[model samples]
Target: MVDAHETFVIIGGGLAGAKAAETLRAEGFTGRVIIIGDERDHPYERPPLSKGYLAGSKERDSVFVHPPAWYAQAEIELHLGEPAVDINRETRSVTLGDGTTIQYDALLLATGAEPRRLDVPGTRLAGVHHLRRLAHADQLRGMLTRLGRENGQLVVAGAGWIGLEVAAAARHYGAEVTVIEPNPSPLHGVLGPEMGGLFTQLHAEHGVRFHFGSGITEILGQDGQVLAVRTDDGEEHPAHGVLVAIGAAPRTALAASAGLEIDPATGGVSVDAALRTADPAIFAAGDAAAFWHPTLGTRLRVEHWANALNGGPAAARSMLGQEVSYDRLPYFFSDQYELGMEYSGWAPPGSYDQVVCRGDVGKPEFIAFWLKEGRVLAGMNVNVWDVTDRIQQLIRNGTTVDAERLADPTTPLPE
Candidate 1:
């Protein structure tokens, strides 16, 4: 039998890190489990920050991955509000911000990603915001509530998933929202112009002003409070609040400090199919890990709930010397106004040859497939349910499906 005294250290207080700690104990690892987080709050999921929490539909405690007492009950030591400042691979030790050093037999770097901030004049103004953390969401909820009460204007930069979701939340609060994006349509790089235009129409219908093909050059402020935003097109928009949703960057300083290989394609720490880093003792997961997929033959960093939900357990098993291949497909879901969407697999706009809609695009429900040489690379279901498994199977199977049947609504998807 293996020694029960082995120590496993997990960095980052997000969903992946929390799940890893839970999995270790559940898998019967009688080892010392330590989870260190920079944030003061308990580990929580990020998706609810923009959706349920921001909309005031979910309680604050609902965001946490587990109850506050669960850690103590599970024998998982938590170092809350303490950030890991250094990683010493030679000693297999990590130093916290408080100058405490911890030794580990295995290490998991689940540091997650940080929201990309805007660089412009007056960006430091009081009304400017970026949603990434639970605390930020709490502050934003109060801000949106006040904005709704006052009918204030909110100008958001970058029409990506977060930006669009925030716009929907603002509208839910009865606040005026204006989105500024340089692309031709919202999510142009992800969903392409054809699909992105749908979102453009969706938000516009709810009174959101879309200033496409333009971006914010500066935030106009008066006495440390935002008053308006100046666009690159030399247009000025009045705003009571500004949200910078440009996107996020992986937190790889710890990985880089430990001399782990960084994926050039993605700015995340590179790991093998087993989520193992260059050092066998170190593994990475969640937004921080750009793992190689055996099936896709490429490295990808997925910033979604599903990745953290599944990746951590896989990495935990691998750390326990169990065989594991973390080849889960990239998946994400989004809710905006009345439209709900679930997307599976990776089909970059340029990578796909054509997009086939299974139902009428004008209708409220449809399944869109991005295909290349008759092979499905990605599938997105709009207002559709319970087809994620079938869609992923198609992508994994790599079958050359008939385009005609795939487009016919009456034809059922292959099992």
Candidate 2:
């Protein structure tokens, strides 16, 4: 029943778009498949950009989603370094930067996101870096290695995940690291002060400095090279380099211009559970999609690796007219020094009633749960092995258990 004449087009070079094309071919779709990418490099996973790759623990080839030859073998039409400039819904066509327009039977927008640049002065100076692309990682890696040899300092802006991860990598390279955050604690937006304190302690114990309640006011440079970064706290930290890890903003201009429905709350292309937009032929997934999650009963736009790894395939099946319900919870993992943590589900600061931790906080090995009215909303495991499946199950089932039992290490999660 497959139609060899149908054409499916994807607009992103990231993991989401690449995986979606793979899924389509795997599902026996003999039709034309095309993927448009703005970046020159082939699609690659992003986690190692700030973690293993940045820390020199992984090779450059390891970051790619697939071998270069795989795309050609799969018969995927790739337009590398060419950005899709316009999406004309009337003709179901997309215009490239080179002025070539391609017609498609179905389209997917996985444009992904870009790192938010600091609005402070002297940001254009050399040695002020950000890690979003593979080239950035390559540059940062060299800088860290040189800084380690020269005994230079690295001032990191924003104590979010990126800031912390890069700070850890800087320390791993034997460079002095200082993290500046505007909030009272690190990761304040997601984990709140209770859990954020743990990371603050972890970094401090490893010789990393934290300047809480501070924001970058300006970056001072001489001869077009970074000298130091000044903070709002009226302090100037000397730095040979600076890493701006403020966060990322999803790229939504293209979708909005196409008159596609975008979720105002998340600034993402609004789509149903099947990842289909207002126009049946157009779909979206990955970071650009603010999709209706059937299980959570709310719209979510996740920017983690797992979402794209799974979201792409789900969108592919839906494009093939399969009944798809994308209800997977938001999940992410981090590596900082000796501590490795995996957090599942979403429980923002004000949404959770209390955070309960099981096991030894001193050993820094435990599982923490964010509960709302005794119902588990999120769970994080630090240095603890396995148990992710059970944690996700508790969230999916909305399980309510006694506080005492939930906190006790001896109590096994019931089936």
Candidate 3:
């Protein structure tokens, strides 16, 4: 049990860190709580960075997880713009960038992840960007507005979620857009080829061009601004700007230096089902954690927003010596123009043998299920609403489902 006099320190003031602090107070922990963040702003939700915020549909205040006054009222100390430079496991203390040290009986590392950068030539050009933080999104939004006025083109380096969402937003602003991907189709690695093709078709229907199975050799620029992207096939796609959404890497330097176990497969801090690292006194959550998934029966690391939102509370409970398991089904959603989709359950590599669909793939609404030996492993609903609870129940129960019945819209999901 945590004593009222003990101190709890959290590094990285993202959604997860904020939520953990909130949970501690809600759970009646009278201990001192401190959160350190590298960014100048308070913790904020990041999903809107690429969609609503970038498109100017959301205001700056709407993205914050909590108001600035909330922390003061909750008795939580926040050190904004001060990054944690080091951690001493022996003393259970964290060193901040300003040469301040904070001791903690329990510590959490929610460092999150950073966008993978392109190492090719011309990447440092003024018009080439990567979206990760609010500032990055603001910069891109301004660029899109300027390019819209000039009728310039945007060349996206990857066809992933961030890339596609940015493409949709850019198109909404009337800027010509082209997406380049190394996979045969967009989101092929996650949604598979057939389902991924639906997204490709969606973009094509909106006048967005694609260059599949292509690799970017270099970015061409003029006067320190992006001019075009040169592909491996000797083709140059002209562009006024470029956005790279290749993926992200977990920020685990402090964890590694503190001698915490790191998952080699995901390059994240390794934790058990309770989200506790090997040290027991420290816990890791959100994008920087590779925890043993109870349902998938394997180590998995999720970069989605839902994981951070849910994992934070679960980790807080564990830190208080509560016997809790972070076994909630993983869930995530994405919005692009008129299309909105929500997916739940784990789809580990080679875990599912079949994919069954309940609605037409060519139409605007559909539910897709990934199954293994007639058991629902994962499910996704595209443009379909009010069925996520049913999908999660089916997966949690490990119910055996009939392929024909599962595919038929007339039959309701198991109760």
Task: Report lDDT (CA) for all predictions.
Answer: 0.93, 0.93, 0.91
Position 198, candidate 3: lDDT: 85
Candidate 1 clashing pairs? none
Clashing pairs in 3: none
Residue 378, model 2: Cα distance from true site in angstroms: 0.2
Give the range of the ten consecutive residues with the poorest summed lDDT in model 2: 1-10
Residue-pair clashes, model 3? 0
TM-score of 1: 0.98
Give the alpha carbon lDDT tens digit for every residue of 226-334 in model 2: 9999998789999999999998888999999999988999988999999999999999999999999888888999999999999999999999999999999999999
Winner of 1 and 3 under TM-score: 1
Where does candidate 3 stray beyond 4 Å? 1-4
Per-candidate TM-scores read 0.98, 0.98, 0.98
Give a tens-digit lDDT track for model 1, residues 302-387: 99999999999999999999999998999999999889999999998789898999886776689999998999999999999999
In candidate 2 the C-alpha lDDT for residue 5 amounts to 94
All candidates in order of lDDT, best leading: 2, 1, 3
lDDT of 3: 0.91
